[model samples]
Target: MGLLSVRNRFIEKLRNFATLSDPAEAALEAATRNASKLPARRDLIREGDRPGPVFVVLDGWACRYKILPNGGRQILAYLMPGDCCDLHIGLLAEMDHGIQTITPAQVATISGGEMDSLLTDHRGFARAMYITQLVDEGTMRAWITSMGRRTSKERASHLLCELYLRARNIGLTDGIELVLPLSQIMLADSLGMTPVHLNRVLKELRLSGTIQLRRGSVAIVDPARLAQIAGFDENYLHRRLRPAIAG
Candidate 1:
């Protein structure tokens, strides 16, 4: 695809929740001019590596995770198309969590110098980036709440809801259906459940008319009911901010 299309994806992602001025749009497009395609299940950035360029997902999914001493892994966050890897990670000495591709992906690497110049010269874009960071933190807090207090059923349902909402906002879904590239094991790891238990919960949701988990896709049969079951709150997503739309 062309660079303009890739930049448009970034614009679509941020414009879902925040807006940018014309200068900001032009800067982002220029800065993200060159992108590389990444194969599925590859490491974009690993734990303990020196911080590298900021990654912006142009297509497909990636995730943040950390490996435990027992060889287990916990998935901290999911990065969808148009979602960026942590921009501030460049400021750290070493990465605490690793980012890896969940599917074949297109990624743009923004060096610290480019990012600093963009932020310094474009106030509106900087504000949008800051808001994006805040929203990411809010999502992490919600994940903590899910892990700490939600039941297994609620936790799974909440994650599905969260992913659905996020993908929908970025125009990745049609009606109630979207491609869920994750395997059962990945979903289980992210939800703090065993594969068996996660399978059982998914079966339950399927049987209860909440969702249909087919191969490579998830279809919410009754989003309202599912959201009620999960007690999902969309306030933290913050989909509205003031700025002019750019071409």
Candidate 2:
């Protein structure tokens, strides 16, 4: 795609919260111009790393995770295309979690100076960023609720539903199907379950005809039924504005 079209795509994401003015578009273009194509499994930021540039996922999947003292890892959230990571993290000295790509991705890095410019001169863009941050916080809250209250089957189904809805919103889905690049181990880590247990859960879902997984793709056969099983409420994702999914 052309540069203007690429910039417009990023602006479309911000427009989910507020209508963008020409100046806001220009500011986004300035920030988005420095994207680098990163390989899959690359760490964008690491725990205790001094915070610097903010990252925007222009394409592919990435996630935020924390490592426990026992070397166990918990995936906190997934970052999708049009999602910006840590919009205000530069204010902090270091990151408590790290961000890594699950697939080869085009990641745009906006420096502290550019971010300051957006806040100082582009008020609309700044407001959109604030909305995005609020949505992220809401997603985290929902994830915590799922872990504390939902069963393993419910947790996995809920995650699948959330991701499917999000991918659809971003035009990444073909009908009810989308690429689910997560491995069983990664899904288990995100759900706080053992890999073996996760396998059983997937088998059950498949046997019941609730979903299908093949060649790194996921198809929700009956989303309504699956959502019912998980007791999932999309409201927590803030779908009225920019809808996002949790990991």
- lDDT at residue 178 of model 2 (Cα atoms): 79
Per-residue accuracy of model 1 over 16-135 as CA lDDT, tens digit each: 544677788877887777778878999998999999999998887899999999999999999988888777887899999999998888888899988988888877677778878999
* Candidate 2 similarity to native, TM-score: 0.93
Question: Per-residue lDDT for 1-247 in model 2, tens only?
Answer: 1222354355677777766677778768877877888888999999999998989988878999999999999999998888988877889989999999998888888888888878777667777778889889988998998899999999999999999988887778769777888899999999999999999999999999999989798889999999999998988767686423210
lDDT of each: 0.86, 0.84
Top lDDT model: 1
Pairs clashing in candidate 2? none
